[model samples]
Target: MSRHRQRQRERGQAAVEYAGVIALLLFVALAAIQLGVAAYAAQQAGTAARAGARAASMPDGDGQAGLAADAAVSSWLTPKTQSGSCGDQITVSVTIDIPQVLPIFDFGSARRSVTMPCD
Candidate 1:
């Protein structure tokens, strides 16, 4: 009877240890996923900047920098854009709010800029 009780107590301790390990692994996986989301947001911002600048540089097209930028990225990662002319060149800047995987990690936003000569 004494040996059986000791074995049961050890099994309970082992179960608790496994639960703690699984929780830790889950947190690490979540952090990795959040980092990937940040990288994707940065890449999207760059794409939006290039597309907007290309559109802005067209001599025959009406200026629609915002429209081009919005079409270049995911719908959830909508980009805010600003365009200006410096001499013969046009520059477009794009900013996007990074998606949150965990509420505690609000890493703000990503931004990118591109310049292209006017056609």
Candidate 2:
């Protein structure tokens, strides 16, 4: 009887250890997903900035550069873009808000700048 009771007590030990490891694994997975989201947002910002810069660099693109940049990114993401020209070079800057999977936390904005010679 004594040996049987000792084996029964050990049964719960595996469950406890599994619970601890599972919690850690969940946290790591969530963190990795959040990182992927941030990287995607950054890439989108860079694409939008380059698109805007290319548009503004054209002879007739100044009037529609903002539209071109907005169309290049995800519809859910709101991007703020600015264009500036100095001599023959044009610069476009884009800032996009990173969407949060966890509502209580903010990952902030991803910003990108691109410059090209005016055509």
Candidate 3:
């Protein structure tokens, strides 16, 4: 009876260990997902800057730079675009907030700049 009771007491040990490991695994997965979101946000910023610069470089694209940048970014992200100097070169800068998948850390924002020759 004593040996049977000891065996019964240890029966759930594996489950307890697994429970601890599962928590760690979940944290790691969340971190990886957060990193991926950050990368995507940075890519989106670059795309927005490029599109805006291309628009600003054109003869008829002076006022359409903002629209082109807004259209290039993903709907889920809001972009802040700044354009300057369209004489010899057109420069556009785009900033986007990175999504926070994990509440433990603040990922802040991503920024990109592009310059294109005026056409």
Alpha-carbon RMSD of each model = 1.8, 2.4, 1.5
What TM-score does prediction 3 earn? 0.91
Error of 3 at 34 (Å): 0.7
Tens digits of per-residue lDDT, candidate 2, 43-84, equal 999999989999888888775557878999999888899887
Q: Can you write out model 3's per-residue Cα lDDT over 1-119, one digit (the tens) per residue?
A: 69999998899899999999999999999999999999999999999999999998999887777899899988999999999868999889999999899889688999999999999
- Model 2 pairs in collision: none
Query: In model 3, which regions exceed 4 Å deviation?
Result: none
* Whole-model lDDT, model 3: 0.92
TM-score of each: 0.90, 0.81, 0.91
The Cα RMSD of model 3 versus the native structure comes to 1.5
Assess each prediction's global lDDT (C-alpha) against the native: 0.89, 0.87, 0.92
Best by TM-score: 3
Error of 1 at 105 (Å): 1.5
* TM-score of model 1 (CA atoms): 0.90
In angstroms, the error of model 1 at 8 is 3.2
* Candidates by lDDT, descending order: 3, 1, 2
